[model samples]
Target: MKKLFILCVFLLAGCATQTPSKTPSACSEEQACTIGDQNTVETMQPLSFEEALSFFKEKKSGLLYFGFENCPWCQEALPILREEAKRQNVSIHSILTRDENNELLYTEEQKQEIIPYLQDYMSKNEEGELTLYVPLVVVVKDGKAIEGHVGTVDDHDAHARKMTEEEKQELQKKYEDMLAQLSS
Candidate 1:
């Protein structure tokens, strides 16, 4: 009986110490991909609120993109934003709601700080529902938001339509003009 008790204790201890597996995947089964067969972007995952804040502080004149890995609009906008960032030579900071492990990355306090900005920029749908959608792009200067866009610029319908090169260039120019105004 003593031997069996000792075995049970050892098993329980091992179970207690076991950590969750870290698999390398874009999204889990619970978090279905909404990108519609497109590849997801490889973005930096901030481990803590401080890290994300520091990124914003360091890149004072940049774009802060809030998104989820499983969001379809986010997936569509990322590549366009990447190209825009390169063309404009501007920094782009990605803030994710959850990590690849489906874990919450932002703390309550951090959400409080960020969500208001996203909320302020949200638009209403045809049904008059206040849409707090993902792929939110905020143009920031000195850690303050100057402008915010809820969806892909030029994809007004949010239907994930394929944008032509001309359309992409026009969108990039629009943001560049906005950033220029903020700088001035």
Candidate 2:
């Protein structure tokens, strides 16, 4: 009985360990609010999955951005994302949820198929207005996925890995270039 009790304590300790926080300590409440309105900006007509998929196939070598309208980081990354996509000449898809604004993005046929994924693959909040925030980028060619993820955790872990000044500069340049392409 004593041995079993000690074993239970060890198991409990293992379960008690906390997941490392992925948010930066410097991320302020103000920044959180404006996360939707970032320094970088890019404009593009939103596309349906079918339209986006066709574009991806035509690009031959393309990047697919998987995200939703409600996620703040997804909004923050959009402009920078545009620059990078322009440089690489890839197609981007701002993902949609059936329960949210995605109503128009997908056909009635697709809702059942995608509903499960939107809820499971992305970080979902039951309350508040919904928006998908995970930053997912897939590089694909010839209908085959060349690089990307099939995992549940897709958001950037800048707090844990940390973003360097050099990386930020490079990202800024790329973002500017993408905006130019979209305008062109």
Candidate 3:
């Protein structure tokens, strides 16, 4: 009986000593509010605009996704991005383009600071002012933007509706090609 008890204790100890899960942290409350219940992507790590810009100034390599939770386009692209990141074994550093109040995520100074690096991907608005659109996935290597893809697909013009499976697959392929550029 004593030997059996010792064996049971050993089994319990072995179970208790198991390593932590590799899953990424759960979405923040704000993220949840933005993303809602359809979120399947768990690899998103939120970072400040300053930190994302530092990757450029410091010449670091990373995948940076700029989007807000309310954006249907962003919500659609996230799962694809997550899968591609997992497949490539890379971490995605995300930057919120807007807050819960629908305000800009960064200050004017921050916008100015990062504009030069992101100008190529930004679009011009009615006033000829540059606008940064959501779901902009940028792969930077040594701080240089190697590849950047904005939105899910070129054919899908509406954000109010979900993309077709074919479109999602196309987006997945786009992400795969983009993430393939990661050197570090």
**How would you order the candidates by lDDT, starting with the best?**
3, 1, 2
Per-candidate TM-scores read: 0.54, 0.38, 0.78
Q: What is the TM-score (0 to 1) of candidate 2?
A: 0.38
Estimate, for each residue in 1-184, the C-alpha lDDT of model 3 and write its tens digit: 9999999999999999976534332245233211212333335667788888888999998888898877888878887788777666667788888877789978888988888999998888899988888889998988988889888897786556789999999999988888877853
Candidate 3 residue 148 Cα shift, in angstroms, is: 0.4
> Taking the tens digit of each residue's C-alpha lDDT, what string does model 2 give over 3-100?
99999999999888944323231222123211121322312334455644565456544445665555445545555665554454444544433224
Better of 1 and 2 by TM-score: 1
State in Å the error of residue 7, model 3. Answer: 14
Per-residue lDDT of 70 in model 2: 51
**Local accuracy of candidate 1 as per-residue lDDT tens digits, 1-184:** 9999999999999999976443222433233223211233323332244545665556566566667786666766666765555454555555666666657766657655554445578766699755546677777777667787766665444454666677666766666665455447
lDDT over C-alpha atoms for residue 130 of model 3? 85
Clashing pairs in 3: none
What residue runs in model 1 are displaced by over 4 Å at the alpha carbon?
1-50, 53-61, 101-104, 116-119, 123-132, 154-160, 164-170, 181-183
> What shift in Å separates residue 37 of candidate 3 from its native position after superposition?
20
Candidate 3 lDDT for residue 21 = 39
Cα lDDT for residue 53, model 3?
A: 88
What is the total number of backbone clashes in candidate 2?
Answer: 2
